[model samples]
Target: MFDIDRWREIFQSINKNRLRSILSGFTVAFAILLFTLLFGIVSGLSNSFKSAFADDAQNAMFVRVWQTSKPYKGLQTGRTIQLKNDDFNYVKDEYESKIQYQSARIYKNFTLKYKNEANSYSVRAVHPDHQFLEKTMIDEGRYLNEKDLQEKSKVIVIGRLIKADLFGEKPALGKRINVNGSSYLVIGIFSDEGGDNEERLAYIPVTTAQMIYGNNDYISQINLGYNPDLNLDEAISFGKQLERDLRFKLNIHPDDQSALSVRNMAEANKNVGSFMAILYAIVILVGSGTLIAGIIGISNIMIFVIKERTKEFGIRKALGAQPLSIVWMVVQESVFITTIAGYLGLSLGTYLLSLIGDSLEEDYFIKDPSVSTGIVVGATVVLILSGLIAGYIPAKRAANIKPIEALRAD
Candidate 1:
């Protein structure tokens, strides 16, 4: 299959129109470069979204109570609805099999002190299961245990950033810190989540929080995780039923429109999916435009080359060269130039993507932009196809020319 004569003729033809060949190659190279960059950016956006959402509890739902915005069921408007321990227990009992984890939270903003070092911080009182609901991982020591909750132990788990700020690389285990003038033992440090403000907070058992903060009768929010096998509609239906039961048991009107709010992770995922879909569409459109332009440029340049070599092609045909050979000669030239230039462009784009991918730090978008192996192979295939297609028409035109007429034309 090694045809030295054919390769030599192809090289001679390209050398005869070196500048035009290079220009044609540049067009294909630029197209591939644009396509690669756009694909990488889209991939980065997808990766960033995944990273941002990975820490969140899967299939989770949140519930909150607020002042009634509308009067219903004989209750006057403006009545405030609040959740209590009874309501949390009722929901758990009703949906025990369907629920994976559940927790109630009481938040307080207070000043924490250790000797002379003091800082204003937020504290959360949560159940042991709250760790699962929040997908929090312990970096050091241990998280609150059931015994801590049952006995109302004055133990606390600080976020990594909080630990760094308050203790500064020093081991913080067994250390005592004052929270709102109440002494609590630091038992554990949470893993860092990369610039999350939540990393600056501290967590304590629900009972200890109620004892010290005296908010046992009130909870600011409730978080629940459900089995992923259930559809969103089924989970939401179950969640709404629980919400109604809680409202009724707590003396809140069932028809109170704004007294209770329920949110599911499914809706959040749908929104994210829509955003990614639109972004991918835009990237494909831009990349396709560049590719088409390059293909057209290649077609025009091949046509020009055919016109310039009309006499030579006629002479070869007159000497018994086959029409397929003539077509292969032109196509080989196109493929060689485009492949070499396109590869260079692809390499450059890949290098740039790798260099900048890790440096991106935007919130929930554009992280780790890099080309995958499949994408590289697909782009190469497109370039090869473009080369053959661009040369086809010009090759046909050259093959149809009569030797006598081509020789006679000035």
Candidate 2:
């Protein structure tokens, strides 16, 4: 029902106690503001982590060799562990169905040049499968294929940043670039969202890299993507099994922790995921706590308002006003204050978060930070519920006031 009389009374009450009403409203607004900022901060942290490790797939795993720390099977403690191309072949042969993609890399730091322009970038020799594992996008031409690997072709794919720097307005396709004095034909251009670092790299056939770098059968790193059916923790266990297998076949000591290391992207993702969950919980608890404090303040003020209006409420009763009317008046006013004040805070908070979110550079841990519509709607609903509770008891007291007793008081 539209209650003009009740609304007029609410406005008159606010007009009379403007300072106190504003102060009460400020409490609710501040609580909402604080909560909004906390939510955005947590979102930023999550985005940062995802960007930081976006270079690899969540199910990806990598293995690198190091010097053995302990002697085993009559081998010297100081013996260096070296993996061969045979290791990659073994996995592809045995676990072909279980794996999604795999690649072996041998990298060399090269001062690459096209005519007079030059840039120092890391050049990696990789399998065609490496393209999918790195999640790289092709801007032009084609990536390294099996033919390039088998024939050991002197063809290279440059990153987008490299193409822009070296080729400028000219097309990079079919052009020849020099890497440490050796000329290689540019076959493709690639790009990544992971920032300029990934853009500064170049990819070539792994066979050619191994041959040219004088590292026959010696890969610097082995990276692979396994079944997506496995979750973060399950994928970690999957990677551990491969690590153990490689150690056994390569004559590396089982206990030689330093001799071999397999880094599981799934494990990294799980830890970050757990931390993000914790942060989300903390944001909810803290936001709820702050809002609750403001509700308490409103409840306290309503109690005081009821006390001061006791005589007025009694007079209304004497004049034949219904108890429900008195209760409703109080409740309506509380709801209005809560809704309006909380909304102002919500708007301010959202604006600030949007500004911050836009300015936040996409990094490893943080990405775009915007509040969902559900959160905004939910917060408003919470405010309205809190208002109803804050006003109920005080309104009930006002409704119950006796006319004779109220009149008898000073």
Q: Top TM-score: which candidate number?
A: 2
Per-residue alpha-carbon lDDT of candidate 2 for residues 1-410, written as tens digits (9 for 90 to 100): 89788799999887776776788888899888888888877877777787777777767888898898988888888888777888889978877766888999887899899999998999998999899889889999999999999999999999999999998989999999998889999999999877899998999999988878785778878889988987766788888888899899888888788999898888888888898899999989988888888888887888877777788888999999999999989988888988898998888988887877756654423467767788888987999998898788889988988999877656
Cα-based TM-score, every candidate:
0.80, 0.86
Q: Which stretches of candidate 2 lie over 4 Å from their true place?
A: 1-4, 180-182, 310-328, 348-374, 396-410
Per-residue lDDT tens digits of candidate 1, residues 1-410? 98998889888878888888888788878877877888888888878877776767758788888898776677778888777887788788888898888888888887888877789898989888888877788988998889998999999999888887788878888999988888999999997453567788889988887776764567788888887778766776777777787677766776775788777776677677788899878878887787777777778888888888888888988999888888888888777777887898899889888877766644435788989999889878977987788788888888888888877756
Which candidate achieves the best lDDT against the true structure? 2
Residue 84 of model 1 has an lDDT of 81
- Single out the weakest 10-residue window by summed lDDT for candidate 2: 358-367
Whole-model Cα lDDT per candidate? Answer: 0.82, 0.86
Candidate no. 1 TM-score: 0.80
Q: Count the backbone clashes (under 3 Å) in each candidate.
A: 0, 10
